[model samples]
Target: MLSEFKAFVMRGNVLDLAIAVIIGGAFATITKSLTDDVIMPVVGWLFGGFDFSSYFIRLGPIPESYAGSPTNYAALKEAGVPLFGYGEFITVTINFLILAFIIFLLVRYANKAMARFEKDEAPAADPADVVLLREIRDELKAQRGGQ
Candidate 1:
């Protein structure tokens, strides 16, 4: 059972999937940072605010013990405030789009590369016996013509 498990884990597809997952996680983090740190800030500035993720509508009343500012979305949420955080959603959506676009481009190029490799392959050579037989047949035809 242990050997079977080891064999299953050591399969090429499984190893490839594991590596893809790790790479995908890192890529996702990069996409998230790009969305939050770069794009959102510019978008927020255009919308007349410096912080885009803080643009939320308060749904429920703040707790009596809560001392956070009313405009602080993260702080209010931490203090058990209900919020319609549309800015954060927008950021996440943009991140997903970026990641999906990158993956699509990668897959498209990879398929093109694979197709090129397949098309460039030379046809298989004939076996030694087949080559020898063809040579003998040509020699016999030549001898018959000469006679």
Candidate 2:
């Protein structure tokens, strides 16, 4: 059973998946930063300095201001208030779009690179071999004619 488990763990697909998961986690952080830090700020500036993260609808009695202006989502949820949270949704949607576009670009580049490599590595047909074979056939035809 231990050997079976070891074999399963050592398989190429499993290792590849593990590596992909780690890389995906890192990529998620990068996308999140791009959406929240870079893109959202620009978008907010365009909309007359409106921060999306703060644009939530308090379901119950609305507080004059949230305590310490809690930046984290969990804190807002814990405040015993149902919230719309559209700003966070917008940020998440932007991240997803950016990640999708990046993946599409990567796939396109990989396909182009594979095509170039295949073209370069293709075996060239020998013109000399073809000429030699034709000459042998012509010689055989001449001998048969003489006979």
Candidate 3:
């Protein structure tokens, strides 16, 4: 059982999966930062400085002791107000779309590269037995010609 487990762990597919998971984690971090720091700002600017991150609708009354501004979604929520945070959802959806598109492009390019690598591969070396057989056949042909 242990040997079987070892064999499974040593498989090329298993190693490939492990590597892919590690790379995916790093990629997700990079995409998150790109969305939050770079893309979101540009999107906001394009929308005439309207911050989508703060867009929300109050579904419940604000608490009487709430000192924060009513328009502040975070503050209203912190004050125990039931709100529908649609702006944050939109931003998150945009981030997901960007990440998915990037991953798609990466996969497409990777497949192309793999295809190119396969096409450029050198032919396999002849087996020792085949080489010996060919040599013997050539020697027999040469002896027959000499006769």
Candidate 4:
């Protein structure tokens, strides 16, 4: 049973998947930073300093004990207030679009590079027997033409 388990863990697909998971986690962080630090600021500035992350509607009244700002989504949520956070949703949507586009570009570039690399490699030659047979057949045809 231990050997079976070891075999399962050592499989090529399993190792590939493990590496993919690690890389994907790292990629997620990069995309998150790109969305939060770079893209969001520019988008917000373009839309007259609109910040979608801050947009939310409190569905319930805030508790008297709650000291956080009423308009703050994170604070309201932490205070146990029910809220509709549409602005935050929009921000996430934009982030997803950006991440998807970046992945698409990477995949496109990789495919083009692979195609060019494949084109540069010469094709394999026919087997020796096949080549000899073809030569003999061509010679027979030539003899027939001369006859």
For this target, which candidate reaches the highest TM-score against the unseen true structure? 4
By TM-score, the better pick of 3 and 4 is 4
Clashes (backbone N, CA, C under 3 Å), per candidate, total 0, 0, 0, 0
Angstrom error at residue 5, model 4: 2.3
Q: lDDT of each prediction vs. the true structure?
A: 0.90, 0.83, 0.90, 0.90
TM-score of 4: 0.80
Task: State the TM-score for model 2.
Answer: 0.76
RMSD of each: 4.8, 4.1, 5.6, 4.6
Off by over 4 Å in 3: 1-19, 122-147
Ranking by TM-score: 4, 1, 2, 3
For residues 1-147, write the lDDT of model 2, one tens digit per residue. Answer: 999999999999999999999999999999889888898889889989977777676666535566844455557777655777887787778789999999899999999999999999999876998989999999999999999
Q: Which ten residues in a row have the lowest lDDT in candidate 2?
A: 62-71
For residues 1-147, write the lDDT of model 1, one tens digit per residue. 999999999999999999999999999999899888888878778978867577799999999999878998889989989999997787788899989998999999999999989988967789999999999999999999999
Model 4 lDDT per residue over 40-124, tens place: 8998899998888899887899999998788788989898999999998998888789878988999999999999999888697
Return the TM-score for candidate 3, rounded to 2 decimals: 0.70
